[model samples]
Target: MDRSSPAGNPLPAADRADGGREECASEVKAKLVGAKRWRRLRRLLAGVVVLGLTGWFALPWVMPWPAALSRPVPAGMRITDVHGTSLRRLLAGGMRAETPPKLPEIPKALVLATLAAEDHRFYRHGGIDPVAVARAARDGVSAGRRVSGASTITQQLVKLTVPRARTLRTKGLEMLTARRVEMIWSKDQILEQYLQRLDYGNLHLGPAAAAAGYFGKPLADCSLAECAFLAGLPQSPSRLNPWRHADRAVKRQQWVLNRLGVLGWADADSLARARAEPLKLRRHYGFFMAPHFVDLLLSSLPETSRAGGENLTTTLDLDIQRTAERAVASHLARLAGKNVTQAAVVVLENSTGNVLALIGSRDYGAADGGQVNGAVARRSPGSALKP
Candidate 1:
């Protein structure tokens, strides 16, 4: 009863069953292999993700977060007049003050100019701007040089707060710190701090100092053209120094104005007016008026306060000091023919040791030992020490 094929061969049932079993086994093995491969791939992907997360969270530990950001701003020695107005700022170790003068609500023109000059999408971005970075890269490639810096204001703040050498690692840290800063501070706060800490050539730090140094006015009182000029200095303070290079500084100011116009922040008439506005820059002889008093105040401070940024209200009357200086100069001029050149004067309040007027020398401008403070200079006490 066995079935025969058309070729006249009888079929074997056991051989057919064995062939079917072998085929089923091969299919099962293939499936198991595929499953194993998928599981291995998933594990590899998961490990990569875990490592990336670990690195992102742990990288800050390698360099350690800067403690300077958390500590109180080290304001250098600020010598103030009796009226509490700052007379001179003696920088401690050449470091700027951490707490700058209170800046008024930033002018709209200044804000627009800053945004146009620095980062246009400052309000919209988080901490980093990938689009700007990509564009900078492309531009750099095309120009064969770095045409633009793709740093956000937040990034600049981080760099200013925690200075480091320019490197890949440092830039990575800046980005990480910038993100943390954004999370902790508001956009306005960030901008405020940036404006407060920015440099404006000739050792002028912050808008307040820059305003006074450049325009002989307060930050709140600076005009629009002055504001624009101040706003354009943070990029390269030395190169854009208004004192050394007025023409270049004006050009940069014009550029800022142009940017403002392009952004619709300024109208054509206003822009033209600003461009034509003349800058009346005052000469900045920093800390010149009260040099001796400043030195005494600095020496009297504690080691901690000597680190700078302290506002010291001395018992010095500026008017009386000027009078004493004039008197000394007049007397010395009269005695010039007698071969007497140097003189010192000190006036104190009758009730207290408060110094009212101090003339350290006849003339601070005199070429002969003008810097030697005669008030505290070591000399024979004469008959005064006898009693």
Candidate 2:
């Protein structure tokens, strides 16, 4: 059957209705397909987010926490004489170091300067600074080489505790370890450990030592300029040595001060004062006494006990030791004409045979064989043995 309108002829009404329904059904099918695709995409994205969050949360548990942090003596060990005078300080692994300052004793200005210079976002970041990492990446891409680093204080601490060659693998491990460290340690604790073990130039191991070595003063007496000066050394200790490379160190120091001012850690007036202040570097030697005897005593103890911060008192008397050293020096001077290069002396208590003093050599600082303990060394038994 055909239908006719007022102006034109048309197909049957049933056929028209059937065509309209078919078009509507096709549109509905298309919409359904698009919705399914959208849902699938959303699910995929959700899965990726879930996996990322899981990994982020679980990494600290899976990675190994550094054992060095739990140990008490990351700073090093100290050896004192009978009268409580510091004789020598042995570093964490028996190397020589200056006595470290307590964390609370370090000045606030130095802490601020360090934060400004090394990691401004130290408090905000967990273990890594995403902003710094992004900036480093962008700069590296622009320069076609690595011009800077993104390591946080936490990461630096991890690297210090577990030293490794600079490689991608090492960096990844450091990142993981740093994350673990942050979980176990507070910000102040991390900072204390880092500062205590920090190696300043010329064997100055900590803030107190650096202050004394560079300015011939204690950490408490260091001025703001001196604090800023020391806060800038750890970047490259050898290159920024104020003693050897004053210009470089000063430049780095100015940079640190500028950062402090810009970051609001220091006021403009202070920064100005620091910039104008002259840095006077002086060489300060560590307290070194009875070197050979200390060495022998430390060697005899178990390695673990050396760093326990225990004061070891011996029967050796300071007066007797000084007398014995003078005697050895006098005897050596007399034998200087006989080609004799070294001398040792040992003073024993009359009744108990306890060694009151032992002079290993004429001079421990001597270059050639001056550390040889002649008293303990095997020598030809001359008539001297016939007491």
> Deviation in angstroms for 137 in model 1?
2.7
State, as a TM-score between 0 and 1, how close model 1 is to the true structure: 0.77
Quote the positional error of residue 185 for candidate 1 in Å.
1.3
Cα deviation in Å at residue 166, candidate 1?
2.3
lDDT of 2 by residue, 256-313 (tens): 9999989988888888988999878787766678887777677688878866545567
Q: Summing lDDT over every window of 10 consecutive residues in candidate 1, give the lowest-scoring window.
A: 95-104
Instruction: Kindly report which residue stretches of model 1 are placed more than 4 angstroms away from their true locations once superposed.
Output: 1-66, 95-99, 103-108, 376-387
Model 1 root-mean-square deviation: 6.4
Residue range 1-387, candidate 1, lDDT tens digits: 455556979758886677678989999999999999999999999999988765555443455454666664445677777877666776644644434654355566666777777888898987788889999999999999999888999899889888789998888889777766776678987887777677777877776667767777656776668778888888888888887888888888888888888878778888788888888999754565667777777677677766546677888888888888888878888888898889888889999989887777766777997777898899987999785
Q: How many clashing pairs in candidate 1?
A: 5
**What are the models' TM-scores?**
0.77, 0.76
Candidate 1's C-alpha lDDT?
0.77
Clashing residue pairs in candidate 1, if any?
Answer: 75-308, 75-309, 76-308, 76-309, 77-309
